[model samples]
Target: MQKGGPPPGRSSTTRRASPRCSAGTSRLRRVCQLRGLASAVGSCSSPASKRPCRGRPESLACRRHGRSSVDGRHRGCMEPPATVGHVLALYPLDRPRAVGAFDASTRNDNLRVVDAGGRQFVLRRYRRNRDPERVRFQVRFQRHLEAYRFPSASAVEARTADPVVVDEEGFPWTLFEFVDGEHFDFSRPEQAREAGRRLAEFHDVADRFVGAATASLLEDDVRRFVATPRAVVDELRDAFGIPSLELELQNFRRRLETIAASLHPERLDALPAGWLHNDYHGRNMLFRDDAMVALLDFDKLERGPRASDIVRGVLSFARERRGSRVLRPVFARGFLAGYRERRGISAEELAAMPALAELAFAPYAAICRMLQADHQDPVAHILGDLQGMRETEAQCAALRQILV
Candidate 1:
């Protein structure tokens, strides 16, 4: 819905997509495969037609809890091809044609992938509530990472050379050079080590890039999770039709409080504090074989206790999904080994790993609770994440062994 020309500091291009181009077809097909809808791609009509593609398809990328039917009941709404072409026309590129575009969005932000000149770039239409200043900080952070030769997306500067641009629709959009790699596969121990090593590198860079714009350590999240009222949990259970959800909620509250109490903030106050990729997880990374080719997403970037960042990654990359509902420890040893190879963890930080690992469980619980009231996707897919965290004794023991 971006309406106008380039922002104040940018130049503008106006080349548009051809009404019907063979190049468009190839792009569309690739996008379909990426979205895990090869079947739907077969019957997709022309972009000029403004018709919806028909198929019952789902995406493992977003891992959204929605059912896709022929009736258009589920799935994020796909953007029109012309709209995509229009957006691309604004940016300076050798080939302005938008061969194919797909909605690679999340619950809050809108992301569309546009293939041009045999390369991919992401156009992110940030949520209305997202702070522009913070987003600019993220843009600078990525540039800093790239400057240090870190594998990260390059934010395409506008004509004015500014990394971010405001579209005519008053929404902020930024284009990032796409990295061609797969999400981190935990089954590969080497990949786990590579991820850990790269993460240490990222931390090293972030440690020096401190500023007043960045918020302080990650206390708000812990406080918010602990403060999740029992009343809210009771209502969530009833709305989601879960019978014993309240009891589960009660248990989470107690455990989170215990962890918070045991891991005092003052002990980690002297630990490295700087900008952090608070949501460092597998889905945000790209791997070419066992090596990490790109690290993605920085929307939640903020100054935080550094060890908590590692703990967050361990919870994400080291856990293995068993069956449909359980996430067990299988890779933490390799991950910790790799991390310690590059960065030093203090005694205080090592002691707090177990607690921070417990704290990491809150987001899964919080996300499931928020989605419980929605009738959209099946709640099981989201709530099932919580089930994986229940095997805590084993996970805590695994963490102790790694930190010891």
Candidate 2:
């Protein structure tokens, strides 16, 4: 929850490779110089060596073959071609074309590409440490949305029919279609209003979908800090130099625990259980011109309170400077309007909004700080905007009055 490097004991750097040399003659020794695996030769030195030499050799021999080499290594072991079908086979796509490629952060292992057919997809090599059940849950969530006609992207294809794909090197990979549209900008009042409305619509329908019973979007965060609230409080104390932060964190923790406890077990047990898109922030909501086109990023879909989705949307609105004021009411009105037109909100559920809003903020703030730390940059952008939120207290107060 605190802003800093990887949790203490973790190393950020990758492991270094060790080398073993074969019993040699002088030719292979000189050939070893050509091995140059550690260097930038784009090829590893033949693991086998015959003799020793000084300068790099032009004719790089293959480790497998004793002497002659063709095309730098061997014609028999030519590299495979990179093609859309290959990507589709690994991660199924309904239809695909390679449009352009871009880089994903080092944190993820995948090659990102905006397909020519106007879809964004990622080509990932397989990795072992991934959870297959989680991947299946995510894919199933997408399918559930599609089945319900919800405004979300569909996972049309995957390389491995199995939800998890482990590549030759034990790396994992999957492709997702890009949901095209700009992220909703909080600076725009109209956009914020629309985002709110769309989110409300999403939540209203999403209520009927099954979500995982044990899953809570905040589970990871809660577990991480449950036993160490003081550590987080101390981190905030260092950052903000505020005497009240410790108490504030303790109070926040109590509120979270109460909310977690108050969740109706019987109601939750009876409700449909499936998937919920856990990350439903502004960036995940795509827009075209003035209208919200699609919501992307299903990486966080899990099981929990349906209200959590609406709460997340509202919190995202609250975090936006200009949008915080106008969007929430507009979204509330629109969402309630839409939900009522379909299924109605209970009085109890309606009354829970304010508390939900309060409960949502702490996790949200912690996430922003964690992201800033992970990126190794000051969260000037987020902090400045949040400061703007503080400045708009009067406006928010007025909106709350109007909504209540």
Candidate 3:
């Protein structure tokens, strides 16, 4: 099986679209209203949370399998047959009452497990190409965060010496204490500030962390981040049947290239490096009211420019809040105030963020992950994440002024 993809032999089938996102094809590109209770990443969001997306046959955030399945069956999922044993053997949990596919993640398949005690947990069933070392390192890192009382999805340790449990098929699995909360709410200033404080605390704790960390995910992708979109513009436009999207994407790509060239890899390397939550954003967070309860999805944990992650987080909040991609003064101030209470982003670091943001932001690149990992039909979810942030790029100077 290819990394971040389904097994080659299993043909993909069309799944029903979530009604929350199927308002219309045109509405598919419309970002969920920040104040409203809809989500930008399909239906996997909270009243406080919003996500950015393009258009697709189905929602990006979806329940993968359950009675909600096409025919009330567990189809197209990777839940091991002996999931109960995996949990019972590895962690301290009662016998599972039921196990079901949780979210529509493409990489590590997430299964929501309910124990006989009615408590919940998420079992991260590793893919065939999954590395035990990498997962072990991530699991250990998770434990370190727990030691500091950081708001991470706590990893449940195995009874054995290893952090991970090996299934009968030899694939490794890590069980995480279930975190049930709404997605990050960008509309609330307190939540934004709270998120910033949490992130700052994360960096503070990570600095004391001692481990052989993974390579930066952005090491080779900086150039691709700028150039790939322009090169694939026409092909993607045709594939998704988005008529006028080519011009918009082309414009954004051109701007991204310019920004990336100004801030080359060497230039970015000049900034400080740290253990980054490489995928830190609203989509990977859980919240309750104004408090960020848990930070989820550490799969992309690695060392990288600290400013890049910080900029990406604020910009993502801006993007998801009613699709207004421009940075709002309130969000910037609130987040930074909270972050500053713990650790500070230097004036120089703040200055570098606008350009780094152009390189780090994912939505700007039109990520179509369904083409790679998801087993959904090509047309069904192929265009699920083509949402662009041309407005954010255009207003970088304004954003920089706000950051400063």
Highest lDDT: which candidate? Answer: 3
Angstrom error of the Cα, residue 121, model 1: value is 2.3
Q: Taking the tens digit of each residue's C-alpha lDDT, what string does model 3 give over 16-87?
A: 343333233122213122112022122222213333222234322333422132111132345322243434
TM-score of 1: 0.69
- Superposed Cα deviation of residue 155, candidate 2 (Å): 1.9
Question: How well is each residue in 10-116 modelled by candidate 2, as lDDT tens digits?
Answer: 22212222233222212222222233211111123333452221222444343332333322222212111122234445554444533222222222333334434
lDDT for model 2, please. Answer: 0.44
lDDT for position 204 in model 1: 88
Which candidate leads in TM-score?
A: 1
Which segments of candidate 2 are over 4 A away from where they belong? 1-111, 114-120, 123-129, 167-171, 187-194, 204-275, 318-341, 363-402
Specify the poorest-scoring 10-residue window by lDDT in model 3: 1-10
- For all candidates in order, the CA lDDT equals 0.57, 0.44, 0.59
Clashes by residue pair, model 1: 3-169, 4-168, 9-160, 10-160, 11-159, 65-377
Scored against the true structure, residue 113 in model 2 reaches a CA lDDT of 44
- TM-score-wise, the better of 2 and 3 is 3
Expressed as tens digits, the lDDT of each residue in 301-348 for candidate 1 is 776677878887777767674232223345666776778889877887
Native-structure RMSD, model 1:
9.0
Ranking by TM-score: 1, 3, 2
- TM-scores across all candidates? 0.69, 0.53, 0.66
